[model samples]
Target: MSRKLSGILNSMHEKNMDALIAVKPENIRYLTGFNPSSFSLLLLKDEPVLFTSKLDIEDASQSSKVPVEELKSLKDIKELLKGKIGIESSMTVETYKKLSNNFKANITDLIEVSRMVKSPDEIKNIKKALEIAEKSFEDVEFSGTENEAAAKLEYNMMVRGSSKPSFETIVASGERSSLPHGTPQVTEIESPVVIDWGAVYNGYASDTTRTIIETDKQEEIFNIVLEANKKAVSAIKPGVKTSEIDKAARDVIEEYGYGEGYIHSTGHGVGLEIHEMPSLSQKDNTTLEKGMIVTIEPGIYLEGEFGVRVEDMVQITNRGNVLNKLSHKLTF
Candidate 1:
């Protein structure tokens, strides 16, 4: 068995779970090498079996680290599942009813918890994704419409070997930058462009945000956000609470009289998915551990004015290591 599968099986054993039914694609991919493009189920026990629809059977057979089988129906899966079945927290209600009937079904996060730390291969993939994204950003000339800029950036990433843009590329410029999750519009590019983009390679992802500023006030706010980012990154270390890292950033922005404007969680874990566990928020108390990769992003939005944000991926060790090589300040 693969190391990941072994580790998960051990976790299940500890919980006295006879088997685990993983319905989430990422969770299934975490245990087996195959990433299901269609509906798939992974029954993990002493000998794990990956069941895929006929559409994916050929691919699953070739790529999976575990045994692969054609899924005839949920009834077949239900029969194989014996006593104390552990199910993922994100399982659909319909699936739960179909496959977990009469079994001791319990929702669990064992797979996600196992994925919190990065393996050496996973780290390498993430670093390569970052490289592709940063290189693409450098090649783009930020003078076109917001939509054009976003399309160009994504195109460059794919040419540089990203599987795809990790998420919707945000190219919010001028006043629109105030919207944290603003979508790129067809309007002409303006000063203070807030570009939050990422690249995915080998299923691992890299997320970052850089604002191109052109005014003294924008620079002032930019510096404050940068300091907050730095302080938060510095606060990351094994044994520290995720909330403390968040406070390190939020406190800096609050000290600058922009607490209310600092509207989101400080950051979140990133891996197979752009957003994962260990969210750096006031309520999350997950402890930092070596080998985990997360983002340290803190931004301030002035309602009628523009916004500025600087984000970088960080790896936890004895101290937090910033992964992006791009400069914090980007000017047009």
Candidate 2:
């Protein structure tokens, strides 16, 4: 907690922000160690305080590292705000309007920027999450409708100790697999089933996707996507720009003359949120750094047909160390 608080304080100092107002639940948990059920706020000054509602006061008092107080309204919170307030970009307009009277709001992502690089404990939780997710998937029976398959996978994750799936499990199969973020339907599971799933352990998340191929054409595209995934993972190293990693995978697909069939960025950071900073894409220029947990997912989406995606989590150290032990190619 001290390390996290100090990092944010130092960053706020550089920005000349007197304090940072953290309203996002994830940000609040990162700082205070208290996950709020109702509305809450963290005033990040030298002497930080967590202001939570009456419903959460008991929990916050017991769990929060910093002092916890009862908040009546935004007016009450405003009285505590000091010079040149720092706010997150995610703050809603209605809330911003209420807090924008006297203070000159500096739209900043101080906490998020700090969160981009994970700590030792955060890494541990992520590894545990991955373990749970992978273990749950190893025994799942993919012999039902897409929606049933999704439900079974989710139930398996919960029984294995995941608080919940990190996000909606992607169980796109057959032609529906062509949709990158497709929702599971009541139809029967088909060949080239794409299962994108995750598990949350102690707030950190593990995300992975694997496609089942049974036809020669599906195998062809699967090999291409697998090549792209492996090449992208191999190219990840400290000091390399994230865009370069995306290009490494994208180049493979483009060279195969299926560049147009490949959609979405190569990957993104995964921790508190499934999608976070340092996006691996053509535009993101953030350099790879140690202690960063990210996903490398490369896919080929063929319209009017099935699609294939292979994804895995990686921790950036001296080089990319793959966290997933599951094989890329899956039978049935």
lDDT of 2 at 53: 96
How many collisions per candidate?
Answer: 0, 0
* Lowest summed lDDT window (length 10), candidate 1: 99-108
- Residue ranges of candidate 2 with Cα displaced over 4 Å: none
Give the Cα error of residue 180 in candidate 1, in Å. 0.4
- Model 2 lDDT tens row, 49-153: 999999999999999999999988999788777698999999898888888887999999778878889999999999999999988888788878999989988
Error of 1 at 278 (Å): 1.4
Per-model TM-score on C-alpha atoms: 0.99, 0.98
TM-score of 1: 0.99
lDDT string, candidate 1, 39-146, tens digits: 999999998899999999999999999999999999998888778999988999999999867787989989998899989999999999999999999998899899
Candidate 1, pairs of clashing residues: none
